[model samples]
Target: MSDFASAAMLRVLVQGMRELGLDPGDAPPGDGEARVQLGLKQGLVQRAVLQGGLACLPLLGRGLRRLAHEPTHQALVAAHSASDLLARWQRLERYVHSRHRCVVEHCDDTQACVRHVTVTGQGAPTAAEDFVVAGVLAALLESIGLRRVSLSFGEQGLFPASDPQGLAQAAAAGASALWQFHWQGRPARGSAPVPGPAAWAQGADPAWAEPVRRAYLHLAADLARPWGLPVLAGAMGLSTRSLQRQLAAQGLSYSRLLAEARCRVAAWRLLYTGDPVAEVGFLSGFSDQPHFTRELQKRVGMPPAAYRQAFAARPVPGR
Candidate 1:
């Protein structure tokens, strides 16, 4: 699990390959739970299955053509806008406990800047894995009736990628395991409210290190529950000392994870709910508004209100 991907993701890559008459041999288990994770150490041999999945533009398209039929594909196609689609994507990551995660750092009418990353305190995902994920995402957009969707990976460039070839070229262009996913995906359909962070753990670390993952999930379950270390530990069926030791092994503190969970809840409300900022703070377990503002400011590099305004600036699909 720590080094592998979900069975669903691997199926896309493997099935996509088979669709193009390519053989993806012997995909490995992610965490002994039947996940076909790409690579933990990122060794070349470990990537054989992932690499053989798709090689070029035409092959990539033919390989991934089955994406539209998958159960996940059906759910993603229901997304009313690009933001809603990604919100759904983030939610799915939690359910599958994926090692890698994607986050939209910025967006507008014609472009969305995303960051491909691993969960906190985990090893980074390889570039090849990132490329395959990018290919799948592009195909997903196409399924949603979106056209002219192009993607480019870089730290600074916001240029267009006219075809899948450009995305493949940029995947091998850098050794950096983590890079920006600057893609063109305009939001579509009419607006609809996204589910809250309770159902969708957006902007929070969902995997890596079992204790931390569980702690974040518990915290996100109910931010305003007046939870403390003893309470959380008790709920997880561990003594306080034992729980503390587990968290220490991961270099995390209970309060820190709680704060992060709160931040995620606040972000979801800001984006999808028309709730007042004060109300958001209260529901996120902040007894004080100033502390909520300060904590969220540190994590997102902006105040809650402004961060909402900046990241939610996308246009309607057809207009």
Candidate 2:
């Protein structure tokens, strides 16, 4: 992904974290700024937040970079915790919106800028969250004084029944991009689409910062793989062993990431599709149905069949 796309992804991520109700702020020791600077220098930001949404920080950082110009990219990895990134995103979103008048202009068809996110992951299926996030971002753009916006998502994103209008409204207002879980080549959860620069860049946020955005795109595209540690490591230009060490510094591992991705994807699939329990398991990286059932129960508090029965019966937004 280009730096521009990375920055946009970051913006959406930070904005989403704020909506999740976490404290995303700078620390008193000037350490917060230092961390960000360091992350820039290192060209990466790696963190694992227990309950604070650190996973979304890189995206936030990418967004913030567009507003400022700095050279520290490699040294910046593993800087802020997820909480810090969220706080920064909230700050930036407010900063941008306060200065501009945002608008939403839907394209009769998807535009090139909008295609960046979708093209990053090979064979990845687009999700409703992409549309949800885009709408939320449009609202934010309008709030910031941008005059026009044009974006679109796949058919899955269009159905009123699948993506809720209320959630879309909240996301557009710089709130969390309400998400829904689903799978493509592998199990994945779709996040709200990041706002485009044309929509968010109103001369309020600084420019000239390129590295942060680069890192953001790297991270976002990196994470989309399904249990391919070697592949992800290669994409980031790190050796598998080195990658493990870096992730260790931030309290994460390939296995854990794989598990998290699988669980979220499985949860979404269970709730969204009519796929059989065994198929959901297989698609989610579970080799056996029993293991899939056990894991589903652990994460969702119900067996796959039961979870589907319950979710299928419930009313969904934009359904």
Error of 2 at 75 (Å): 37
Per-residue lDDT tens digits of candidate 1, residues 1-319? 4454544556565565566556556644222132344452233223433455324322243243555543334445556456555665665554445767887777555556667788856666555566556566666565555666665555322122333344445555753233333334454542221235557554556444777677787777655444689989987888999988887877777877777788887787677665455446655666545777898899889987787677753521210
Alpha-carbon shift of residue 318 in model 1 (angstroms): 39
The deviation in Å at residue 184 for candidate 1 is: 7.6
The models' CA-based lDDT, in order, is 0.57, 0.36
Name the top lDDT candidate. Answer: 1
Q: Which pairs in model 1 have colliding backbones?
A: 1-30, 1-31, 4-37, 5-37, 16-63
lDDT of 1 at 90: 63
Q: What is the TM-score of each candidate against the true structure?
A: 0.46, 0.29
Q: Which stretches of candidate 1 lie over 4 Å from their true place?
A: 26-64, 155-319
